[model samples]
Target: MSKVPRVGIGVIIKMGRKVLLLKRKGAHGEGTWAFFGGHLKFNESLEEGAKREVEEETGVLIKNIRAATFTNDIFPKEKKHYITLFVIADFAGGTLPIKEPQYVEKLEWFMWGKFPKPLFTPVANLIKKGFNPFKV
Candidate 1:
């Protein structure tokens, strides 16, 4: 079997001590609440892809992105896997999109200790580890 490495990006944007979250609409981790992000395209660097995704999905421009955390999702029994890089950044754009394709059901900031349970797997673990990218 061959192992596939997928590069993705997530942001931890804080507003007055609150973090942003979006409810997934479709695809992996659908129906769960997670950070705003997506897969990296062929010609894009991780940071570039991260910035693009964050803006495209939320219409929010991320500035001063800092490495946060790395996560590995491996389902050996089922031969499924994913490696994700999480980055923390500051949100500096107008209000978020309230539509499909980018169909984030809801957007809200929440206190760290009061975040909801059953968060998207990668995100939940990253948050649990305190968002340190190089740790992985």
Candidate 2:
């Protein structure tokens, strides 16, 4: 079988002391809480993809992105995906609708210790490590 490569972007958005979390819908981690992100489009750079996804999924424009985490998940029986994750801060943009309806079922800000359970694996891993959702 031939191998296929996939690239994805994830962003950590912060508002003061709280971090934003989105509830995903109809995708790999559907119904799970996660950061704002999505797959990269053709010829798009990682940073570009991340910026676009953050806005598309959360309606937030990320101003500062620091390279902090990288994850590669490979499935021998399926496909391999390379993910570029960033810790974003100091953003300025319009307030997102209470809910994004299609991509996200809900959007909420939570303090690390107070975040809800069952976050998508990647985000959960970060939170578990006490990774400052804001700091890179």
Quick one: best TM-score, which candidate?
Answer: 1
Off by over 4 Å in 1: 75-79, 99-103, 130-136
lDDT string, candidate 1, 1-136, tens digits:
2467666677777665677888887666777788877787888777787787777776676777777668876545546566777777777777777534545778888776567766887777676667633233
lDDT of 2 by residue, 37-119 (tens): 77879897767877777766655767776666755544344344544455465566767774357778888878755877677
Kindly provide the TM-score of model 2 when superposed on the true structure, using C-alpha atoms. 0.78
How many clashes (backbone atoms < 3 Å, residues ≥3 apart in a chain or on different chains) does model 1 have?
Answer: 3
Clashes per prediction? 3, 0
